[model samples]
Target: MKKVLFGLLLAGLMSTTQAAVAQSGSGPAVSYTETVLAAEIGKEILFRRALDWTENHFSYGPKTGAKSDAAAGTVRVTGTGKVTPVATNGKELTRVIRFDFVFRATDKGYDYSVGSFRVIPDPQKPEETMMLSDYIAQLATEKGNGKTFNDRRVTAQANALASEAAMSFRSFMNTMPAAEENTVGIPATE
Candidate 1:
C-alpha cells in the first residue's frame, strides 16, 4: 500500500510539472501565416481590398500607419491590441500586444504573414517591452508556486490574440467586396 501511494503521488507531481512547462511557452513564438486564393481578381483590386481591410480592422480614429505599394503589390500594417490576464489574486493585468501584418498581392491571390509579437507589460512604461515568447520562457523557469496559474493565463491570452488576428484577416481577405457604381453624371431615378 505504501509503495502504491508513493507511486501515485510521484505521478501527480510529474504531471503537474509537465503542465507548467506546456503552459509556459516552451515552443516557438506565436505567429500566423496564410495564403488566400482569389480567382479572377486582378492584382490592383486585391491591393485595394487589402488596404481597405487593414483600415477597417486596425483603425480606431487614429492612423494605423498602414502603407501599400501598388507597384510592388504589397501592404504593411502595424497593429496593437490589449489582452487581460487575471493574476492569482484575481486582479486583471492588462498587456498591450503589438504585431505586424504584411500582405503581398499576386495576380491570382494574396499572401499574408502576421508576426513580430511584442508585449508591453505596463502601459505607463512603454519602453520596457519584451517578446511574447521570451516572457513565456521566463515564466516557465520560475518556481512553480501559485505563479504558474498566472503564467498560464498570460500565455493563453497572448496566443489567443495572435490566432484571432490571423483568422480575422484570413476571413476578410477571402471575402469579395461589393462592386462600386460608376455613377458619374448619371441622373438619380428615385
Candidate 2:
C-alpha cells in the first residue's frame, strides 16, 4: 500500500512538471490577420482586387505562388521573405521565412490572414526548415544569457514584416477603382 501511494505521488509530480514545461515553452506565433469592411463591394470585384493586390504586392520568387478561385471568392498566396537577425554572438543569421496569405471576399468586405510562418535554416535546402513557433519555443528553453534576445528579435522582425504587408494590403483594398467612361451617350465613330 505504501509503495502504491509513493508511485502515485511521483507520477503526479512528473505530470505537473511536464505541464509547466509545455506551458512555458509554448507561445503565440508571429502572425497577423484582419477583416476589412468595404460597403457595397461585390464579391467578384473584391476577388479581382485581391488577385491584383497579391500580384503587385509580392514579387514572385521560385518559392512563391498564388491561387485564385473566383467562384469561391478566395485567393491564397505563399510568399517568402528574408530575415537577418544578429545572434547573441554578434553574428548575423540570415534566413528565408515562408508565409501564407489567405484572402476571402464577401459582398460586405474581405477577411485576410497573413501568417503561417516557417523558417528555412538554409535557403539552399528548402526542405530543411522549422515552423516559427517551434523555433521560438526552442529559443525560450535555451540556456545562457541573451537567449530571449534572439527570440524577441526574431518575433519582432517577423511580426513587423507581417504587419507591413497587412497594412499595404489594407490600403490597396480600400482604394476605389477608376470609374468607366459613359460611352452609351456618345455616338461611336472610327
Candidate 3:
C-alpha cells in the first residue's frame, strides 16, 4: 500500500513539471526548395518549430533589425531561441542557448547573417535551450523550477553563440570554393 501511494504521488508530481516549463525537441533541419543560385529575390525563411507560447512573445521576421516576415534573399529562416540565466549582475546576465533554423530558398542569398533570421521566443520560460548539454547540471534533479528561465547570463552566452554561428556561415558563403557548393551545400543548413 505504501508503494502504491508513493507511485501515485510521483505521477502527480511529474505532471506539474511538464506544466511549469517549455519542452525541448530535436528541432527541424534546414531544407531549401530552390537551389541557391536559382532562388527568387524576396523569398525568405518560412518555417516554424515545436514549442508553445502564451505571453511576452518575441517573434521575429526577416532582417529588419526588429522582426518582420519580409526577407531579402530567397531563404526563409525560422527557429526558437531560449535564454537561461547563468550569472546575473542585477538585470544583466549570461545565457547558454541552442536554436535551429530551417532555411528554405526564397529568391537569392542575401548579405544578412543568421542573426538576421527570425527568433521565436518561448513565452512560457522566455529562456530556451539550444544544445542538450548546456543543461546537464539542471537535469540531474527530477524537480526543476525552471530556474534557468530568462537567465541573462544564459541569454548573453547564447546570443554570443548565435553571433559566432553567423560569422562562420558568413565565411562559408563568401569564401567556400564554388566547386564545393554541391558537396558543402548551404552555409546555414547545419
lDDT of 2 by residue, 1-190 (tens): 9999999999999999999856653458788988888646677778888898888765534446679899989999888887776666778888888899899998788899889999897668978889988876666656632543566677778888899778878887777565412333566899
Off by over 4 Å in 3: 1-72, 80-82, 86-109, 115-151, 180-190
- In model 3, where is the ten-residue run with the lowest total lDDT? 46-55
* Clashes per candidate, residues 3 or more apart or on different chains: 0, 0, 30
lDDT of 3 by residue, 70-117 (tens): 332223334444444432233533332334432343445433334322
As a whole number from 0 to 100, the lDDT of residue 49 in candidate 1 is 77
From the highest lDDT down, the ranking of the candidates is 2, 1, 3
Scored against the true structure, residue 51 in model 1 reaches a CA lDDT of: 83
Give the deviation of candidate 2 from the true structure as CA RMSD.
8.8
Give the Å shift of residue 55 in candidate 1: 1.7
Models sorted by TM-score, best on top: 2, 1, 3
Error of 2 at 66 (Å): 1.1
Clashing pairs in 1: none
Candidate 1: regions farther than 4 A off: 1-25, 59-64, 143-148, 178-190
